[model samples]
Target: EDALYQKLYASLKNRELATKDRTERNSMFARRYPSHAQEESKKQHDHFSLKAAQSDASVEASRLRRQQHFTELASIMKSSNESRINSASERARHHFATVQGEREGKWSNTRQRFDEIRSREQEQRDQIAEMRIIHSNELSFRGTKNSGSISPTSTLRAQTPGSISYFSNNDDETAKTGAVADRLISRILKAANSGKHRRPSEVGSVFESSNCVSSLNTSPSREKPREIDDNATDKTQI
Candidate 1:
């Protein structure tokens, strides 16, 4: 009985030692390797971090794209505005040039018309001056001789080889006629020189004076008196 008790106690002690060693070995392995639940939690954390980083990158890229689009739009708008302004400026210049050209053309035409009228007036004045000179010379020539009675009121005689005298038997009538002729001639000359037009009444008076002088020239006249011719022959004989 004593042997059996000893054997039984030994057996119990061995079993306890064996159980303690096995428990210590299990603790060591647990410390050396992580649990499945802990690894899964760590992987989830890493995945969340990567997803957040990717989202940030996407947002930055979107911001860049939007900025580029805005810049391009601004450039296009600026170009369009400049083109419109240039077009407007060009149109304005063209309109101004057209208007100015038309005005110049009108002014040139007006100037040409004015020059034509002035030239025509000048030509008329020149014709009048020539006519006056011719009439004056004719009047001097027609006054040079007289013998037979022309009219009861007037006579013409030689004053010198180159000159003549004309007078009326009535002194008042002669003076009046002479004064009228001189006044008419002076007025006509003044009007021509001053570029003034004469009234029809005044022109008619001048024509009347000319007709009177022409009538005097047309009247019968002897070449010389008979007494003067006889004296001239006697002088030649002497």
Candidate 2:
């Protein structure tokens, strides 16, 4: 019995030790599993943060590029506007110069025309003065010629061709008296033929008694009456 009891106690002690060892191993396995899981979670969080940072940097770069492009475009537009303005100014200057040249040309033409008109007026005035001088000279010459040839002595000389003197009777006076007597005789003959009964003695008495015959015969004894010849008398009567 002593031997059997000793064996039983040894068996009980060995079983207790085995149980303590198994408990220690289980505690160690639990601690190691929790530590590994914590490490994996930290790694995942770091990857997500890095991707977010990269995305932010890309967005900033795109914004900067857009701003630079806009700045360059504005500068180009300003340069184009300045060029257009300069071209317009140059055109305006050229137009003004053309207008000034035309005005000067017109002024020159007007001055030339005025000078020509003045010259023509002066020529006309000279011609009128010359004409007046010529007219005055002609009138003076005509007055002098008319005054020189109308004297009393010139008139008496112009009439001297027809004067005649009769002592018994000049040829012109005898011709005129004979013509009167012949005309009376022809009248008396015509009266006798017509049975009016006038005699030749009666006709002579009527002729001698005429007042016109007595006056013609009794003219101034110093100056005789002028008798016109037959041809000259016809011309004068005409």
- Predictions: Cα RMSD each: 19.6, 34.9
Model 1's lDDT to the true fold?
0.62
TM-scores of the candidates in the order shown:
0.47, 0.33
Tell me the tens digit of each residue's lDDT in model 2 across 1-238: 9999999998888888888876676566647787765675577788888888888888898989998898999889988888998998899999999999999999999999999988876665654455445434423322111111111110111133222122221334434443443454445445544545447687557656643255245434424434434333111110
Task: Give one digit per residue, the lDDT tens place, for model 1 in 1-238.
Answer: 9999999999999999999997786566657765954685588899999999999999999999999999999999999999999999999999999999999999999999999999988887775767576446535543233334333434444444223344433445455445545555666677777777778887676757655454333245633322233222111100
Taken over the whole model, the C-alpha lDDT of each candidate is 0.62, 0.52
Clash count, one per candidate: 0, 0
Location of the lowest summed lDDT over 10 successive residues in candidate 1 = 229-238
Superposed Cα deviation of residue 150, candidate 2 (Å) = 11
Clashing pairs in 1: none
Candidate 2 weakest lDDT stretch, 10 residues: 149-158
What TM-score does structure 2 among the candidates reach?
A: 0.33
Q: What are the runs in model 2 whose C-alpha is more than 4 Å off?
A: 1-49, 118-238
